[model samples]
Target: MADAQATGPILQLQGVQTHIGPYHILHGVSFEVPRGGVTMLLGRNGAGKTTTLRTIMGLWRASAGTVTFDGTDITRHSTPAIAQAGIAYVPENMSVFSDLTVAENMRLAARTGAIDERRLDWVFRMFPALKTFWHQRAGVLSGGQKQMLSVARAIIEPRQLLIVDEPTKGLAPAIIQNMIHVFRELKQTEVSILLVEQNFHMAKSVGDTVAVMDDGRTVHTGAMAALAEDDTLQQKLLGLSLAAHQ
Candidate 1:
């Protein structure tokens, strides 16, 4: 295997295709997630953004093409194997164990079978509410708090790549701002992130680069600043102006 650190992209997809049963979802999707920054996956509804994330995570295997992670081909790897390779995924649903306490839910996410105190402390610093409700059941938490717990679980240990889908979908404005802050801080740790978000403001604020998907294929890829600055390009790819979303 090549040295991952020497490679520029932590994750790369090339001509990736996925089919959910008989329905073809991802048709030759391709993109790259740079080594140490947030990469936003942006598109309109039914654009296969979530499908792309799932394919990368091995929840849905790629029927064709390749998903290379830090120089490894992971397209055919199992979900657990993909995770073991140091990629953590937080799906759009924020799938926390509703019956479990915050602590229990977190404990389950730790692959080492026990949560490291130092890393737990880091998670607490990013989300104080999780610390406050350590013993509370996950189901009883508010929407935004649940989202935080989901993210905290993914980062309870070190990971090379973090893939999150639609994190700001229904979050309140204040909570969205908090999430933006958390993402910014996480990037400082040199963890590469592939984030799928509909909130253009949050995407623009935290994203260093972006890949825009449309009709199950990647149509555009470039610097996030470039997309944000060009209203005409934003309209062409995303079908909406970033300024209007602000």
Candidate 2:
């Protein structure tokens, strides 16, 4: 492992633990997402993957340890403050405003609350549905359209790190395949991403690094290609077949 101090992980979680009500979630989870690529967080349903992401975004407080980004300690920062510091998070439950138009939803995510034509055009290229439904209320969009809106909203402006929770969740095979291409394109933008996903095909396609968590802690951290090619290890960690990932 490269020394996090020197290599500069865009997001670093060191012994982070989280507690939700009476249940202790994230028991000293630790991982590093190096700069300029996707870091796939892979695990079973009950693993602390989502908890770790929420903790990083300050949506959940860490009970112990630290989360640092770009040399600043953000473990105790407020959610809005963390967002201001350049972390954009898209949860599995796509949260587009029901009453707002697709354009309006993107405006709300903007720092100045106004559209940037170039950036909006860039986003439209990734999710063409956004362009088609520019004036339509977000609530009327289909599942895949809503998901695309959620992601478009996040990148309406530049963000240092993008943390996405299962972008392919509940989508049709065709939609999922489209998202895989979108993520592949997003990766080429050179922005760091920490993605929590169960779709191994997309994970293998876009991920450069990998982290496997179980029982509230990271059990493995290495190259995504290596994990994608090792069926035995994929089955052991995620009950997924590496052959399917390819």
Candidate 3:
């Protein structure tokens, strides 16, 4: 992984607590996504990883504490305003417009209301299936293709930070490799990424830093390679051998 580029976190959550309706989900959740790298948020199912992503995006109001993006407090910002600040979120549900063509979906994600030719070309290069399916309705795409479209939509406009929830969900091994390649390339552009992923291999392969979450709180933080190399730590924190999880 490249040396850390920024002096501070591109995304920071401090003592953030969230309550969804009657359920108290996040209990003072806190972590940071370092600048210029992929920060993997790993945990077992129901660990509040998805809730954390939603809180960061203002999809869920934090009952306490803060979410700071690029040094600006965004805990109370509207979703659109938060997005305007250059944070793009790709949720597990993907949220692609089923009725819209792939091209239309990309257009909607662009701040200018139209895709930039150069940027579109760049993304198409990374995910050629997207360009091949450009005129097709998003509803018809396979699971992997839909995931690709979700990512493509998030980057239709240049963003300072990108937050994704379980991007490899339901993807085959080949698709996971492709996603890793796309992320590795994106890292070089210096657009920091915060990923919630359960696939241990995917996390280790693409992450520069990692945070382990359990029951809505971060339990460990360290370099990805360190986590990958420590089998005992993996068993202790993740409850399985990292190799076995893959």
What does candidate 3's lDDT look like per residue over 153-209, in tens digits? Answer: 998788999999999998999999999999999999969999999888899889999
Q: Candidate 3: lDDT over CA atoms?
A: 0.91
lDDT of 1 at 7: 68
Quantify all predictions' global Cα lDDT against the true fold. 0.94, 0.89, 0.91
Write model 1 residue lDDT over 125-153, tens digit each, in one string. 99999999999999999999999999999
Better of 1 and 3 by TM-score: 1
The TM-scores, one per candidate, come to: 0.97, 0.95, 0.96
lDDT of 1 at 154: 94
Model 1 has how many clashing residue pairs? 0
State which candidate has the highest lDDT: 1
Which candidate number maximizes TM-score? 1
After TM-score superposition, what is the CA distance of residue 41 in candidate 1 from its true location, in Å?
A: 0.5
Show pairs that collide, candidate 1.
none
Q: Model 2 — which ten-residue stretch has the worst lDDT?
A: 1-10
